[model samples]
Target: MRDVKACRVCRSPLPRAGRGRPPAYCSRACQAKAYRRRKNPPVPTPAASRRPGRRRQIAEALWRIAAERGLDAASMREIAAEARVSLRVVQYHFDGKHELLLAALAMLNADNERRARARMATVDVDDPRELLRAILDEFLPVDEQRLLALRVFAAYFARSLVDPELAAVFLHDGQPLEELVATVLTDFGGIPDPRREADLLVSGITGLGMDVVHGRRTLAEVRATIAYHLDRLGGTGKVPGAEAPGTAVV
Candidate 1:
């Protein structure tokens, strides 16, 4: 038997029992650093012909199809055709229809949240009320991303009513919104019952979003309606330039 080669980083004897290529590093840390360097090596962007992985490319194509047509309308065969892969390839990556839909929903939500966080970072409001307003407004159907997300969420919510597992995931995703509203009520609005207020705010937001998604109301109308309720709750007291109805006390 030939002698085993030592790891380049740690000088440890490489394992000869592995099924595949011999690792260049003895441990994960050195492996990660090496991967990072290789990934970011001074290669020109135009010369880099590396494309998205098959799974990622498929997922992206499916997302585009889903965004144009509802998920129910986007069949697996059509998605496979759009992704330029075999239908079996899609199935191999995802367990089933529901799992694929769940993955798509998760990816869409994550991308939306990332964009929302980036937009929120640009806001430098000192007042918590204004900050809350900015954050909440980001969820409204004011743009293509928000509108698409609202549409997808509404579809999932309607479907979740009949599917237990989907319902579980929906509830898990909604927890963050509830917590955000609770924080804003307690810290910014100075509400005595933050939990109750948070629930109410979440309910209102959900209802408004549904209405917008269904085309029952325009985004500006929904914003105005929410502003009316918010003015009564915390806006009048906390947000400047917001006046209380039937109050002479400025």
Candidate 2:
């Protein structure tokens, strides 16, 4: 008599086949699980211990790659090597490169938000000038960390132009950066059209930040330009001899 065979994955009894090749797993679910195990295995020892931090590790690796070598170089194998993990580990954490890209962008947005909040925490919220400065400062590549972040952001922004998935990360319905600046302007209590001014300021600062990142302008020059704009917006209690409202300042 033929001996009963067991499922490879669940070890459950396998139904006898009439005259075909023997079955491996008890069910399709088990079969898929077995395949996944063979494909990804398990993260080993110390790395496995820090499973929670792996996502951030992988995202940060992508950032470094994008910042230094450009985003196109950030393949799964390269990211895994950069993060010092096996490629399977990255695959285990993220479904695919596109999913990973979205995750990394989300992580970056959250990190920047946290940094902005931390910077603002030191200043009194009632002080619109200081609060506004804090918010804009987060955008500038004034230090090494911020510099790396801005560089990575530039890479993501470029890719977002063609990729709808990446573009979705930037497009959102809510109080955008401009609205936040506009709200602060409203508190400052002088600008006629806070929203329009906020829009221009935000756009101008973004352009200036990119300029600094590309070495076209020094940090000092960008900071001076920001200070000049803030002064016009009544940063220091409304500057004397400032251009009149509705007058184009050349």
Candidate 3:
């Protein structure tokens, strides 16, 4: 005698259809409902998801504090209050301000890198000047989010002045970018000293961002400056009316 099977959903006795296979559910409707329940369960989200959300809240609080006030103002207690979590919660995710600073920096850098990658995807990598323009645009504070992020960056730089560990993190963050840009300059600009050019361009782009943040220049003027600099570098003269190698367009 064959064993009787019950429906997975309604627990009703199941009648097998033909000799091919045993029925897991009594009816198609029951099977679909069961599958739907399995797919979209009513249970609360797992703790893993909630934990990251809490961590993000704390990090965002830290970012805001760093940007609005200073990193010094991002003490654990203040972060707890800002994040609306317990001080222990903040301490649980991050041992101290250094760890919190690193977390916030990771978030900030991730955002910047995401934007940079997206922009680079659409740009012409074969054209070095355009590539540099795409890369440096990510460095600029063209809009509100970038502006706030740059403010947070300013706060972090000031804090890193005295903290060697923070300085190390800053260097770690920048070294890869320098290497990448140097490689690009080597390929596109026919520059002999790619590293030197990369360093200069990185610093120059940073200064341009700072200038924009400080009201020293408009974003269009910044783009024009970048174009002028890249034009001097002279990748390929594909675009019409491109500036000459020695000329500064603006």
Candidate 4:
């Protein structure tokens, strides 16, 4: 007697086949249905299937290499070697050095937004001050990853200023940051002019970040400076510092 079991697709009994994995469907109809289901699931619009995580890993490796060795010295071959991927793979994903650099910048922007949002969610204070403090505190050069990301961003920003082509992409990507800041301030602090307030806050934070990255200001001093600004902005008095709302800290 052959072992038999219900097919996963149509719940029909399946006969044992030659030595191999058990059949998932009982018959051609069930198999076709299963295939159709996999081919066209009822899920909402799926995200682009590009290997962004893989690309991000490669980009980070490239950044590390560029930092240790000057960007001029770091070639695609070297980047591929560092990332443990083939040169063709890198080229297939990016056109050239400029594209790779842009990709790296995109990765940095995305990672920063993710980290900032995560930190903000953990802050217990509902007042704009605490939220501002939370966002700025995440900017401090307290860790290697943050420091590296800031350095890359500053470098790209400088390069974009001189390169008109790069400037367009840089500005396009940066618009979101300003918008996000404005939204947060408007919602939390009842900021009258969200856009202007966002611009001002982003400018202040950027300048402060540059100083901190260059070791011109201590972490405590930076935090205090930002806190002072937050106090002036009505963050401190609005809501008492308490546990963050219900959300994963990061």
lDDT of each: 0.70, 0.82, 0.78, 0.70
**Stronger candidate by lDDT (1 vs 3):** 3
Candidates ranked, most accurate by TM-score first: 2, 3, 1, 4
Give the number of the best model, judged by TM-score: 2
| Clash count in backbone of candidate 2 | 0
Identify the candidate with maximal lDDT.
2
Candidate 2 runs further than 4 Å off: 1-50, 235-245
Write down the TM-score of every candidate. 0.65, 0.77, 0.69, 0.62
CA lDDT, candidate 2, residue 224: 84
Clashing pairs in 3: none
- Which prediction has more favorable TM-score, 3 or 4? 3
Candidate 4 runs further than 4 Å off = 1-53, 66-70, 179-197, 235-250
For 181-241, candidate 3 gives per-residue lDDT tens digits of 8888887745667788788888889998999988999999988877776765655423336
Give the TM-score comparing model 2 with the true structure, all chains together: 0.77
Residues 28-131 of candidate 4: C-alpha lDDT, one tens digit per residue: 89888778868987455222344777788789887787555545555899989999988767775666888888778777778888887787778875565566
Q: For model 1, how does the per-residue alpha-carbon lDDT over 149-172 read when each residue is reduced to its tens digit?
A: 777676666678888988897767
Clashes of each: 0, 0, 0, 3
Supply the TM-score for candidate 3.
0.69
